[model samples]
Target: MGILERLSRLIRANLNDLIRRAEDPEKIIEQALEDMRAALREARMEVAEAMAELRKLEREQQSYAEQAAAWERKAAEALKAEREDLAREALKRKQQAQALAEGFAQQVAQQQALVNQLTTQLKALESKIQESEARKALLIARKKGVEAAETVRRFESKVDAHSAVEAFDEMERRIEAMEDKHKALAELDRNDIEKELERLDANRQVEEDLNRLKRELGLA
Candidate 1:
C-alpha cells in the first residue's frame, strides 16, 4: 500500500467521530468515501507493480536454469569426445550457471512471498472500501431525511407568518370599506337637507308674490 491507502484507513478508523464533529457531515462522509476510492486505486497500482516484479524474477530464474542445463549438456558432450580440457571448461560454465540459478531461486522465493502479501493486502482493502460504501449510503439517506424535516418546519413557519400578514391586510381593507360606506351615507344626508332648504325658500317667494298681486287688485 501507499500513503493514500494508509491515510484512508486512518480516516475510516475515526469516521464516526469525524461525522459527529463536522458541520456538514454529508459532504464530509462523501469526501471520506472518495478518499477511500483513491486509496483503493493506489493499492491496485502497488499490486500490479508487485506482480510485474514477480514475473520479472520468474523470467530471470528460468533463464538461469536453462543456461545451467545447456552448460551441463555441453560438458557431457565434451567428455564423450575425450576432450578433458574442454570438459573441465564446460563443467566450470555449468557451475557458474548453477550458481546464478541458485541465487535467482532465493530471490524468486522472496518475490513470491511479496506478491502474496501484496495480493492479500489488496483484497483486504477492497473489502473495507466495499463495507464503507454500504455504510455511506445509509448515512446519505439519513442526511436527506434530516434536511427534509427541517424544510417542512421552515415552510410551516413561513406559512404561519404569511397568514398573519394576510389577515392584517384583509382587516385594514375591510375597515376602509366600512368608513367609505359611512361617509357616502353622511353625504347623502347633507344633500337631502340642502334640497329641503331650497324648497322652503321657493315656497316663501311664491307666498310673497301672491300678496303683492292681491294688494295691486286692492284685496290685500
Candidate 2:
C-alpha cells in the first residue's frame, strides 16, 4: 500500500479494542505508540521528497518560460532587420519553448497539489501521534494503577480496572471522532471546478502572450 494509506490505517486503528484483546495493555500501548512514531518519520520523508519534486518542476517551468521570452525577443529583433524568414523561424522556436513551458507549468501545478496533500496528511499524522503518545502514557499509568490496587485489595482493584476500561473506551471514541472530522474537511476542500478554471486561465494567458507578440512584430 502507499505510504499515506499505511499511515491512515495506523491512525484509524482501534486502540481500545487492541488493549482489550492484548494480554498486556502496557506493552501493547507502548508498541502501538512506537509504530505511530515510525510511521510519522516515514511520512516526514515522503513529504520532503514531494516538496523537492515540486520545487524541481517549478524550476523547470521557469527555465522554459525564460527561454520562450528570449526566443520572442530574438524573433522581434529578426523582424526589425527585415529578415522575414529568420523571424518566422525564431517565432517557431518561441512557440516550441512556450509549449514546453506550458507543459512544465502544468506538471508544477500537479506536483504542488501533491505536496499540499502530503503536507496536510503529515500534519494530521503528527497530531495523531502526539495524541496517541499522551493516551499511551495515561493508559500505561492506569494499567499500573490497576495492578497495584489488585495487590492492596481485590474490591478496589475491580473498581480501578473498570474505570481504566471506561477511560480507554472514551479515548477511542474521541479518536474516531477526530478522524471523521479530518475526513470531512478534506472532502470539502476538494474542488474540481477550481482546477478546471485554473487550467483555462493558463490557456488564456498563453493566447494573450501570442497575441501580444503578434502585435509587437506588426503582424496583427
Candidate 3:
C-alpha cells in the first residue's frame, strides 16, 4: 500500500483489540509502538529535506530577481546617456534576467507547496505516534485484567472440585459407619442363637443321665 494509507492504518488501529488478539500482548504492543515511532522519524526527515529544497529555491529566486533589477537600472543609465544601441542591448539583457527570475519564482512557489504538504503530514504522523504511546499503558492494563480474570476462574474451579471431593469423602465415611453398625447388630443376633442351642443340648444330656440312674434303681 501507499505510505499514507499505511500510516493511516497504523494511526487508526485499535490497540485494545490488538492486545486482546495478541498471544503476547505486551510484546506486540511495544513493537507496534516502536514501528510507529520509526515511521514518524522518517516522516520528519522527509519534511526536513523538503524544507531545505524550498529554501534553496527561494534563494535562487531572490538572486535572479536581484540580477534582473540591476540590469533594469543599467538599461535606464544607458538611456540617460543617449546611447540607443547600448540601451537596447541593456534592455534585452534585462528582459532575459526578468524571464529567469519569473521562472525561478514559479519553481520556488511549487517547492514551498511541497514543503507545506510534507510538514503537515509529518505533524500528523507525530501526533499519531504520541496517541499510540499514550494508549499503550491502558492497553497493557486491559490485558492484565483479562489474565487476572482467567486466573480467578481457574482458582474457583479448583476450589469447587476440592469441595466436591470433600463431599464425596464424607459420604463414604457415613456409609462405612452404617455398615459397621449393621455388622454389630448381626453379630449380636448370632450370639443369642448360639446360647439357646447350647442350653437345649445341656438339658438333653441331663435327662439321659437321669434315665440311667432310674434303670439302676429298678424304676424303669
Candidate 4:
C-alpha cells in the first residue's frame, strides 16, 4: 500500500482506546497530532508530485500526437511525388507515431485518475488534521482546568490540615486579652480631681459663714 493509505488507516484508528492504553496522555496526544500533521504534509507533497507527473504525461501525449501528424504530412508529400516505396515507409512511421500517441493518451488518462484520487485524499487528510488540532486544543484546556481545580483542592486541604481554625481562635484570644487590659485601666472608681473640687467647695462655705458671723457681731 501507499504511504497515504497507511496514513489514512492510522487517522481512522480508535482514539479512545489509544488514549486509554497510553502511558502519558499529553505526550501521546501531542505525538499523534504531530504524526497527523506530518502525514498531511507528505500527502500534499505527493499530490503535487503526482500532478507534475500527470502534466508530464500529457505533454508527452501531445508531443506524440504532433509527431504522428507530421509523419502523415510527410506520407502525403511522398505520395504526391509518385514515390510509392517512400510513401509506404512514411505511412509505416506515421502508424508507429500514432500507436505511440495512443499509448501516451492512455497513460495520461490513468495518471490523471491517480492525481485526482491523491488530491481528494490530500484534502481529506487536511480536514482530519484540522479536527485533530481542534480536539488537541480542547483537550489541553480541559486538562489545565482539571489541574487548576486539583491544585485549589490541594491548597484547601493543606489549609484545613494546618488547623486555620486554631489560628483564628488564638487571634481571638489575643484580642480578648488586649480588651481586658483596657478594661482594667478604666476600672478606677473615683477621681483625684473630683475629691479636690469637693474639698475646695467645703472651705469656701466655711469662710463665707465666718465672714457673716463677724459682720453680725458689729465689730466693724
Best by TM-score: 4
lDDT of 1 by residue, 1-220 (tens): 5444576667766675667776488778777777777777877888788889888888888898899899889888998999889989988888888898889889989988887887787788788789988999898999899999999999988987897878999999999999999999999999999999999999999999999999999999
TM-score of each: 0.63, 0.63, 0.66, 0.67
lDDT of 2 by residue, 1-220 (tens): 5566886677447565576676476766676777788888998898899999888988888998999999899989999999989989998998998999999999999998888888888888788878988788778888889898777798766777797888999999999999999998777666666788899999999999999999999999
User: lDDT for model 3, on a 0 to 1 scale?
Assistant: 0.82
Return the TM-score for candidate 4, rounded to 2 decimals.
0.67
lDDT of 4 by residue, 24-119 (tens): 667777878877887888888888899899899899889988988988998889989998889889888888888999999999999998888887
Question: What is the lDDT of every predicted structure here?
Answer: 0.84, 0.84, 0.82, 0.83
At residue 113, give the lDDT of candidate 1: 88
Between candidates 2 and 4, which one is better according to TM-score?
4
| Cα lDDT for residue 74, candidate 3 | 85
Query: Candidate 3, residues 132-158: lDDT per residue as tens digits?
Result: 888999999998999999999999889
The clash numbers for all candidates, in the given order, read 0, 0, 0, 0
Looking at model 1, report the run of 10 residues with the lowest lDDT sum.
1-10
